[model samples]
Target: MAAKQVKSRQRVADHGEVFTAEREVKAMCDLVKQETERIDSRFLEPACGDGNFLVEILTRKLAIVKKKYKRSAYDWERNSLLALGSMYGVDILLDNAKACRDRLYEIWEQEYKAVCKKECNDDTRAAARFILERNIVCGNALTLFCVDNEQQDTTEPIVFSEWTFPFNDARIQRKDYTFAELINAEEPKRPKKEGAQQTLFDLYPEAKPEPDEEGIFLQQYITHYRRLSENG
Candidate 1:
């Protein structure tokens, strides 16, 4: 049977909670086949209801991770985290947000335990959960703000984390930007002294990143991949 698309009439009335069918979800995902298969391409669903769309995207990313990195548990673990980190979701319903996070973790954990069995560690698992927690949000996408249990808007604006292994090392870096900032992001026009071309690092040095827009960040954190749970 097809997966149930509607949870209940009450939910539909309250939040318009109708989930996309698996068949339609897959067909839509196929339209972006190459990006879906790219291990680190980022995807965000403004209204992810229990992650039907995000789950399918993650599944595709994990399959690519497994195919390329399965031989070595180390490679598998790191790439899997990268795949998981790249997905993002937001839902107005708090229950839906929480459920989405759990659903994502369960899927990641099942694949993780199957592939990395003896080599798996709690820290890595926790890191995966942390990524889901940060990536999935209980918020009003329309208002660009977070929401409380009663489905009312909260004072806090919606913020999303950008994760990357900045260096070719085990450490991961996270920088937070408001949903508005990202949506409004544009290339900064540069000034030239007539004959000069400049390297990117000249403007954005390694020690300091010069964002095009001021106040684009809320906070930043860095930690070893396995130890990411400790920081955020």
Candidate 2:
């Protein structure tokens, strides 16, 4: 008999914990296949801790690609390795990030070796290695900013000023948006009822000041009453 599935587990899967189960992995692959008509696909795991999702995605995508093409086993392996670019990930921990990259590379290497029926070359290995390292960046995904929060510079380099290059150029600098600031700005702007309502008497028929009061004290009294009435 199969073991019982654990219930009441923690909310999110961390670095050590395996996030995607065997069944879930298959389900995800099915979803991907159904949604995308194209053989080539792209998948990204924003918080990929140890690359559980990426590994499954790579495995399934490769299998599908190989079956569809019906090429030789060598082609199958080459295409499988090439599928690494379809997957991307990000993790904060350096060690975990490195381990995740290594794990993905190992999967690629194993498939490549089987297809070649001989040792893999430096170029093939290097391609896999580069994809793993560069694609799986070491950074906090939560801190990641979208397009709107990008930096702007009126002061341009004297040379590039003539040509209209994008102010928020990726080459210029890597920009980061504050999650906190965005959240704060999104909060509802409360109406200024208190301050605005203070002058509400100005709209009333009796609101106009009386010039009929001739004496200084009477004028002051009238002014005070007007102020008090308006405020109240």
TM-score: which candidate is best? 1
Best by lDDT: 1
Off by over 4 Å in 2: 1-18, 35-39, 68-78, 145-232
Task: Output the worst ten-in-a-row residue range by lDDT, candidate 2.
Answer: 156-165
Enumerate residue pairs that collide in model 2.
none
Residue-level lDDT tens digits of model 1 in 94-116: 88999999988988999998898
Q: How would you encode candidate 2's per-residue C-alpha lDDT over 15-114 as one tens digit per residue?
A: 3333456677567667766533333465667767677778777766655665654346434534554476556676655655677798888777776665
How does each model score on TM-score?
0.88, 0.49
Tell me the spans in candidate 1 whose CA falls farther than 4 Å from its real position: 185-208, 212-215
